[model samples]
Target: MDCTRSYWNGRKAVHRRTMMKGAGYCDSDIKTKPHIGVANTYMEGSPGTAHLRTLVEKIKQGIWAAGGIPVEFGVPATCGNVANGAEELKYEQAARDIVAASIEFVAKVHRFDGLVTVASCDNIIAGCYLAMARLNIPTLCVTGGSMTAGIYKGQKMVQAQLDVAVLGGESEEVLLELEEHVCPSFGACPSMGTANTMQMTGEIINFVVPGTGTLPSTDNLKLRRSKEAGEMIVEMTKADRKPSDLITRETLMNAIAFAMATAASTNIVLHLIAIANELGIKITLDDFDHYASKLPCIVGVIPSGPYTVVDFHYAGGALTVMKMIESQIYTNVPTMDGRTWKELLANVEAKSSDIIRTLADPLFKEPGLKILKGNLSPTGSIVRPTGVPAEMKQFSGKARVFSSDLDSFAAIERGEIVAGDVIVIRYEGCVGAPGMTELMVTTDALIAHGLHKSVGLISDARFSGFNYGAIVGHVTPEAAKGGLIALIEEGDIISVDTVQGTINLDVPENIIAERRKKWVCPPPKVKTGLLALYAKNCRTADEGGAMQPWLDDETN
Candidate 1:
């Protein structure tokens, strides 16, 4: 029986049927067809979601053709580019939970038999996954594919390059040309940034159609796939195939293995953990490290390599990458369309070996991402080992601490930061900054100043996927909670060895203990608002930084 029947089939549901008629639905349309919720994260003027309305129209057509009713609802979707480097960045991570809760509220209230989430960008896609797991309904996601690469002065460009160029003090004409051309289309940034990473993560975990993750946003095939997703949701609902049926522990391990092979954004670690939590599965940094050790980084997508995700798409996308690493991942797990991964990838092959290399001839035999633990980060910290410059991978430097990203950025612009320095940005974790804003602005400034290879950055906050260099982020037990990062003084020595998976403070144990004894926790930045609530209750970085109330229960 259809879940919507509870609201429309009974005589007591006369008010509901009357409400549906007012909305232009016939009694038969309400009673005979299953209702599918289309949770759209489309907002005007946002590059990632501007074209989603067109996809939604096609999805509705497919739903109607399949004898199902499609109901579209709007959810919050924000751009990190707009929020970067400002106080507004604090809201970026919080928007993920807001999007998830909004979808859950709408789907539960309307009694949808199945759900189809339409989203682009980082937080929106992660939020959709969380909602799917929480609701445990037959659900499918439609990814808004990557934008086309921009052309500037006969060179291909992306958002990350533009960010650094803007701070590099280029001539007005050059800056204007780059600003106008860096984002030539309305879709996610044309790299393996958080947006594209999470999109592919969905497909790897079997929450999306097989090839939809890497299609260009303007590709006609994307529209066709969106329609197909609608039809699939109806079939999935009929079969009672929920997210729980497909996303087992082994399936999640496959997702992580794919992330490792592709050198995906470190932000994926937080998202996968959060998705697992919603399904009552326990995932930690150890799970990511386990895959990172076994899977070779094969895809040469920026900022880990020279090519863009557009190249990855043309070179066979997610399917080819999965084929390359099939031996390392689970192959018998079921996908959204009822085929095991082994069956889905039977005839796939990489079109370009340079873009998606085979496991035997991979881009980097070293791991893609690593979890570093030491006195500084008692829980753990994250770094993309594949992205770091070889010269800076295992260096010791003096500590140059800052309380905020803007302060460090200003110091970089003033030539205060130099070689052999570990720039520490603290008080910016989930409970500290109350949102754990990305540190791309400061990292971009370092690149603009030509210090990306000379200096290193460590933070309790997060970093953008476009960021590279000797950078470590997501330091646990954040400064607000008296982490070791808050106790460092200027000129104190700190060592980071990405190759060995360790980050340490050279100071003695007695001195460190004394400093911690004197350390004072700062008050919440926001006094009363959603951020204040988030600051008071959100989990630490290692625990996915989720804001759910149940997760806060120590006994649970």
Candidate 2:
């Protein structure tokens, strides 16, 4: 046989991959086989995980078929559906550290040629990004896909919103049925929320196959994509390429720009910051607004627009947005296939006007989130302009704040909170709330009374995926840490000047200074566990909501 024919026939020598994975084997097994790592996040704590296990099995088959061996590795699981508060915050930061470490350790032990990460949830996607940075391995993430759009009275909603609405005050019967109907399958959120955006970021940065990023878990297309990714990983492995090739500093900026233009989850800011920090790169909220200007808000997804990820997939997926924000994304950045961002967009176009708009008539016209500086937030904070009311864009409202998340919750349930209220959910920062937990229940209550849509939430923490309001999260120097947020009290008048890009309390400097002296940190919820660890080392949200202990390690 000719050399070409022999080379093609010899593609079946994947057994060498198994032997390289620290498994005892004879030299005969060491053929010129490509080894692939299947970094699968399959744990019972999260519902979307089941799909990953099933998907990994298919990846294994595809690796063998492509003349590559696939070694599967597992990482810690973070279940958003169950955990809440600082404990959840504890897990979020830990997830990133754990995944990055796991991938590095596993790859070194297995000698894998490339990696295929199977993930879907919000934390999982972020964790995978950190993992990709650590191993710097030829990597690809095949998301389980967002869950089918949840329906209520034939109207579709995402899972997080459904949970929030019910928890806030809807009847248990309605919530139960809606919960069952809302997320009927195992997938990611269909909304243009954090989970969907992060997964697509992987594709836009040329981390995953472009068009394959938005398929849902139940769709057969996801399985086909998984197989294709398996094959792609084998090819990447043979090329000795790693994730850093695709996820360059330029790509990180592109991802941030996309997140802002789409008005995606606040989680992206934190996630991207952490990923950059892990890679020894610097990214700040200013970069978020910097790229936000050139990019247009054309993506038609919820909280920002009217569609879901399902509609986005059929319309154009990441390619659609990339084409719109081409200028924002440096076309020079390298990709997984050794190509540039422009090369990836060559064959793609915005197929549907509804899914992806053009700059001439962009949906948002500018980035959805804006960075504001004021006496209130000396460092900075990010807020979704789309979630806020147009009339109150430049409001000088009173600071009807809560000292803590629990007090905020109590006020909402008691009907004490109302529209035009500048609800301050404080002490829930990296060192304060120590977990940056979502006050979904409180936001839901405001939603129930039609107050959520109008009121603005300013806090030193995070929000739920389902939320839509003029909520501002991740306030720096949080109340517990003695930031201006602690000085806010119930009935204290405050001001929000979006036009001027400032958020400040109306109180005099002398009075505010007096309030500061009396402010005290809230007591710890738990005396032990990761929460304790988080309390001891976690930084403010502006610092990527990560543990401060690791801060010195990176610098060291």
Candidate 3:
């Protein structure tokens, strides 16, 4: 039976049908077509999502052509670059949950037969997938795609380069030129940052249409794919092809393998775990580690390599990369197009060997990302091995602790952060900051000062996908919760070995115990509003930093 029947089939729904007709929908439109919810995260001033309005129009056209009623609705969207370096940044991660809850609230109330989620950027895409898993409905995602790379001095440019130049003391004229040209079009940053990472990974997990993730936002093809997604979702609903049917443990494993091979964002770890939790599927840091050990980094996108995601798209995108590592990923999994993975890439070929390398001749012999565990992070911590230089991979230095990212950035600006100092930024974890803020500003400062390789950094806070260097982040049992990071004093030694996957506080065990004994959990940074509520309910980073009210319910 059509789920929309509950609102339009009988005399009981007369008022609903009247309201629908009043809104310009006719009787046949209400009775003969399925209701497809177009959950669009479109907001002006956000390059990643600003162009989504056009896609939504095309999607509606496709739905109408496919005999479905398209009901458009708004969802929260945020730009990490806008929120970075401010207290407002705390709302960034929290926005993910808001997007998920918002979609759930509206879709459940209106009883959408199928959903077409239009989103771009990191949190928005992750949140949409979380919503899909929570509702277990027939859904397809439309990623806004990557922006075209900007050209400065005849060299391609992306957000990371602009960030480094701004802090590197470039001339005002040069900076102005970069500001104007770094983002030449409306779309996600033209790199394998969180936005593109989630898009590509989402496609591999079967939540997105094939070829849609890598298409440039300005390309005419993206609009066509949006319409195709709208039409595909209607058929998926008729077949009862719920998210659960497409996304399984094997599919997630495939996503992880793809991420590892491509050297995608570390943020994928948190988003993937959150989506898995919504589906009652168990995924942990160990799963990431397992794939990291087996899969080699092949894609050479920005922050980890010389190319941007535009180059990646031209290099044959996700299908080419997947085909390159087919032996490492699952091939029997179901895709959104009703085809198996093997069938999807049966005739695919890589267009550029330099951007997407073969398994035998990978960009890096090691995985792009790794999970580090030691006394410092009893639970776990994340580091991107592909971003670290070989000389700094196994380094030890004196601790220089700061309570916040701002303080750390200030010290870097003041020339107080010297070479061989392991900068420890704390009190910015999920519950500590009330939302785990990205440390892009501080990382950029380090890069600007030429300290990225000479200095090391560790944080309870997270890092932006564009950040690199000798850094570790998302230290579980974060400093605010009185983790070992909170106990480190100035001049104490810390060691990080990305090759061995270990991050250790080199102080004596007895001394460390004493420090922990004296350590106290700090007061809440935010006392009221959404942040306070998030802090009260949010789980640790290792648990995906999700707000699981079920964990607090004793009745269950």
Candidate 4:
């Protein structure tokens, strides 16, 4: 089997087939060389994908010891800890159409020449960033990393945010013997939420492998960086280099300015507004609040900070926050490693000022993430812009609507919240909760009973970058398209500003024309499967939470 390679149709195939051609090995040692697919989301009760099947058996022994011919594939997970009896928005729109039609049917019907993805959590890296902007091949995303330090009762706890803080006061067979040494084969939950801020902002926009996004998946440098990413993907399948040659718009505005100075996850502004509308490029949460008011939070982990994701990979990853915002990045885009994010932060070395912070010394002067714009998100709602406060950023509050999330966890078990109320959730979104759950046990029981600075979670759909407060996510004509957060009521007043991005509902227009003459439109939660084709082709998180016909050719 002359060192592998295969492609049955779109050219190249002296041999080597098998999406399952009876598993053996050489097809004339993969003729015509260069077929590297590897996608692998992995779930059957993933102990974080059992360290991704031992880093896919060392990336198939480094793609057959590096001659290129690694066809491995399997994507199907997102139960978010086995949520039991299905229909959890059909397992999140069947994980965004099984990673958008399996990277457009494995690169135009078995026409591979590079694709590696891997993934860890949070809807497997938002369905692998909408299948790497629709599989522009020669890809490389390997994040079967992060899981170590869990130790409850004397602080430090991560690996699955189940900080029952003493396992919710013990008993119950010591929570079944600490779930048998709590699933660690390291690889996700070095806690900075949304699966380590979308795979370290998908390797600060190169889609993984520069400081291998917080390596850990039970280390050995994640099995020698998964066999040096299968010998650097046979030199990116003989130098073809796809992934839209380094996802542009100046590297997606340096990954929305490093997810706005690491205040990451409002589901990374809904998967960077559906991977910049699958790359027509228009990412707004007001361009994540104009790059979170001119960037500079410097990797302060967690629901906002207190580290993890292996404490942001020993405080270096994103090459030391791109060398402390090296003049707010764009240093001529290009990477998967052809060089430049200013040549990998020219030897970065910022070993902590409390995990990289100092653009003239700063941490929380704002930019955890906030971008609201009135009439209850008239196409704007996202709050986290750093541990919120400043009088809970201009809310008027009173409304407490909750038509779902199990009637707001039965009003948090009938404690029917008080202290400046305003929790409005609804039938969730993405064309009617066809997959937008994660309010994370009512935003961690309103931040473990401190009323997290006087409550404020207003949604339509989407949450859980692992809990933090003053919530408001992806709310656009949601309430299943009847927006106005379903013409809200229960004691309306709802203001919410978050630094002028808005959420208003201080109603007036004839009491919203008397509730739009009694709106109805509810019925289609699952007319059939794949959440009835993403509730008939999803779109509207102000047009970039994907499915506006899978965005691209520069979306309108």
- In candidate 3, position 303 carries an lDDT of 80
Model 2: per-residue Cα lDDT over 358-412, one tens digit each: 7677776556677777888878887766666676677656677665666776787
Clashing pairs in 3: none
lDDT of model 2 at position 174: 81
Which candidate, 1 or 4, has the higher lDDT? 1
TM-score of 2: 0.89
Cα error, residue 433 of model 2, in Å, equals 1.9
**How does candidate 3 fare on TM-score?**
0.98
lDDT at 547, model 1: 83
Ranking by lDDT: 3, 1, 2, 4
In order of TM-score, best first, we have 1, 3, 2, 4
lDDT of 3 by residue, 51-121 (tens): 99999999988888887899999998889889777779878888889999999999998888899999889
| Candidates 3 and 4, the one with greater TM-score | 3
Cα lDDT of model 1 by residue, 35-57, tens digit? 88999999897889998999999
Residue 217 Cα positional deviation in candidate 1, in Å, after optimal superposition: 1.1
Q: How close is candidate 1 to the true structure, as a TM-score?
A: 0.98
Off by over 4 Å in 3: 1-4, 551-556
